[model samples]
Target: MLDACYDTSVVQSAVDLANTLKPVRGEDFLESVGQLHDFLDDHPALGPVKPSEPAEQHAAGARWSLTEEDLAEVRSVRETVRAVLERASTDAAGAVALVNDGLRRSRATPVLRVGDGGWRTEVVSGTDRCSAHLAAAMFGALASVIATLGPNRLGACAGPNCRGTFVDLSRNGSKQYCTRACAHRVSVAAYRSRNNPG
Candidate 1:
């Protein structure tokens, strides 16, 4: 599981970006490239900040500056990531294979740094576009999540009207809904049905 805070680096930014692009607020808010661009601009963490050679100051990563091509690629990446998450939710091995293949395609490599705090692992990407970076980050974060929390921790929303997905980082791993609002919507609907019974 990713640390509650990125005291280390912006490793979870990809995960944050992925979660945000998903039909914000249970609505299809990210269907078009303009919306995706708006999203990147709306959220600071969603974009990667180009750092020095030693990989320093990653908090304010470089602006994505998405082009027409990048947007198209991002659409594809998002679809593939959603599939990977869904598959991993039910099948761990399959998910691993998918992530490995994606890493290969994105040319992402795992780097080990030996510091005073001991050795640690981080994903390094050579890609320049925002979409490619996010794809790599999505795979890396998902891989880390599977290693720590298990496959079932990631999945799509349970709400009938919502097409969003999420990673359940709750305590008991009993997170049945994507958000509390979705859960409440479902609960209120159930209560109303029970009371009316029409």
Candidate 2:
């Protein structure tokens, strides 16, 4: 199971959620989270967990498919989260603002209250009604991941050709690329640059 710690699964989920809104070259929303979990599960060094299928469908002919507008909204949310992750300092206000913006964009009202020793969230009203619950869940999950990624661990990808932000959970704080593949690409580029100067 993916604990609150900043493990491979948590990092993958954060990146996946953001990328689901605006996928990179070869990512599909349907299998993004699952694939991430699969990788984590295979890596015993990093806690293992079974992958859960996305509750929503992305099929060409599904009764409840994501629309262009939905994609846009998701993208906005992803951008907001990315902004927070890339900030030099922890932005509590910005986090709240982002949550509010997401709720507003979803046409949902989040109910805030002090419970269980801290602030808790709930959806008071909305289109889907369940949207509030989902938002609360997402917020909680993100919070857990953020807690694990101390201020120094959050960063933007250092791949020269990539601009995605990511949470670096490596022990040495040396993670630069958003993904291993990107890291490999960066290495190859560096090697070429060293071997054959322009």
Question: Which candidate has the highest lDDT of all?
Answer: 1
Model 1: how far residue 194 lies from native, Å: 2.4
Off by over 4 Å in 2: 1-11, 21-72, 88-134
lDDT of 1: 0.63
RMSD of each: 4.3, 9.0
Q: For candidate 2, write residues 44-81 as lDDT tens digits.
A: 32111111222222321222233455444444555666
Q: Estimate each model's TM-score.
A: 0.74, 0.51
For model 2, state the Cα shift of residue 79 in Å: 2.7
Candidate 1: deviation at residue 78, Å?
0.6
User: Over 4 Å off in model 1, which ranges?
Assistant: 1-34, 42-65, 112-120
TM-score, cand. 2: 0.51
Q: For this target, which candidate reaches the highest TM-score against the unseen true structure?
A: 1
Q: Give the alpha carbon lDDT tens digit for every residue of 1-198 in model 1.
A: 344212123333444455655564554455666777665655444334322245433332235555678777877776677676656677778778888887777777665655455665655566676666666656776777777778888777788777566776667787767788999999999999999999
